[model samples]
Target: MSTHVEGSTDLKYVSDEAFIDTGVRKVVSKGNWQQQYMSLRSFPEGDRNCYKIGVTTGTKYLIRASFFYGNYDGEGMPPTFDLYLGASLWDSVKTSSSSDFTIDPEIIHVPQKNHIHICLVKTSHGIPFISAIELRPLDNSTYQAQTGSLALLDRLDTGVSTWTR
Candidate 1:
């Protein structure tokens, strides 16, 4: 079953031992961005922040995290940070334009354990925040290559043809 965990909503999957900030905002413009979001309870305090979500073991899922910096702090400055899946690095949440909503997607990943950890690490620039977290179950055929011990392949071309000399 697919799960859409709104950052504003509380759940049993989230670790209670730790603290995370949750609040709602009045979004002037509406379309893709959600009006409410959950942010890190504290900023630049911990070395790493994690969200432990329970799931069925051996299940393949596509996880996505979204962020909308609506000036929750009223400072008009959005923070940039790093996001993590388990012990591996997933992606960096860079809030370039506070008005633009940012979404990060992770391909098929089969968790051997019953739970997966989603983490946010504070960057030198600003704090970390999350607007929402979504998970969707994927069929075996979705990403067969990732079901095994293999990892995603990233290719980069630095040739003059592809890059500036």
Candidate 2:
């Protein structure tokens, strides 16, 4: 399920909003996402803005974080920051030219513990902010690899022949 990090404390849902930077915005955009999005939490002022999500240990899952600037700060500038999964760096959120757009990054992994830590850290450019977070369980058969973490190389279509037979 997706969690909106405004002011929720439901354990089954996303808890621990009492300890993060808070910001409210009313953004009108062409995309439907901006409509459901009501608030955004920042990380420049806080010591550490993170969410502890409960999950089955040893289970594979996909976690995603989204950020929508929407010019909430009235500065028309999108922030650049880093997202961390547990102690490892996941991805960096970059700035967008428009406030109506959003930046979403996701990771797939098996947690070593019963809980996973999702954190947003400030960079040298701007403060970190998050619009939403999502955690989904995946079947073990999906994304099997032979060694360490696998990286995406390229995607090809087998239906279409590229070379002469």
Candidate 3:
């Protein structure tokens, strides 16, 4: 099977500014021109994260990412992050506020230039913390998903992880 993904910087427009980013923990620099993977400001007690990213429009686009988050004082996924694509935040999974997710393998089709904008928004009692995020073109791993628990798939499930006490 073949998949279309947005790979490396072909025609990049990012910046060259790096910041301490008190909210996300690790240090990060703007991608290029107006493009960046930024962690804006912190919440309050430090329980969430936020970011801003931009892309040129009119091209078929696909991005793959893995988010690594830190833990808090038994509150949950430590620093809970709210993800926003442009101004519209995605109300998917979790509490619509906090989620620690693996790459869900999603592809976004672009219809125009300077048309797509993504914001990684976080909301918590404080600022959220993140290690690193890998956003690039989709690869073979994205198209190949292990279904129904294949022997090669290294995963385990309780089969009833949602059982109530």
Candidate 4:
């Protein structure tokens, strides 16, 4: 998990919502977690970490959350991590584990009809100060642009026409 920000090497620092110093001690819910960037600590502004995140069950493709730190070893401050892989509200899923998953992007396919969830159970198993996370999908080379941006792109401009072609 490469850092989107230069200094913040932890993958957990992506949403700015994943905070440790924001007076908020935790972040979780059955489905909805903290979406507000300014409210959380530890996390920084920008979603460069999510850039490497893709969704799918191991049947289709593995999820490689390539973050900076590991929730292994009893060293993390909180001792927990979580990952939500779906793009919509309906596709949300989760995983709570004691060990950290690998980040090697591969071609091994699996069944991922719904959303993928990779939660690093944040209280007992382990803890890590993440800086980035990378998930695995069949193809995510061009998904960085949010679908809602299609409308904005239609009316947007760069003062140049050569690139559009």
Best by TM-score: 2
Candidate 2 residue-wise lDDT, 6-65, digit = tens: 334332334236333343224434344533344666665663467777789888887767
The model with the greater lDDT, 2 or 4, is 2
Query: How many pairs collide in each candidate, listed in order?
Result: 1, 0, 21, 23
TM value for model 3: 0.39
Task: Estimate the lDDT of model 3.
Answer: 0.35
CA lDDT scores, all candidates in order: 0.61, 0.66, 0.35, 0.31
Between candidates 2 and 3, the one scoring higher on lDDT is 2
TM-score of each: 0.65, 0.71, 0.39, 0.27
- Steric clash count of candidate 3: 21
Greater TM-score among 1 and 3 belongs to 1
> Candidate 1: lDDT over CA atoms?
0.61
For candidate 1, the TM-score is: 0.65
lDDT string for model 4 (1-165, tens) is: 212433443333345243222222233222322232112122223221222233344333433433322222224433333333334221111223323332222112343444443332233333323433333344534334333211111224559777576
Tell me how far the alpha carbon of residue 38 in candidate 2 is from the true structure, in angstroms, after superposition: 3.3
For candidate 3, the C-alpha RMSD (Å) to the true structure equals 12.8
Output the worst ten-in-a-row residue range by lDDT, candidate 1. Answer: 19-28
Residue-level lDDT tens digits of model 1 in 59-134:
7887767676666666667787888888887887777454566555454578889998888888787767676666
Give Cα distance to truth, residue 131, candidate 3, Å.
4.4
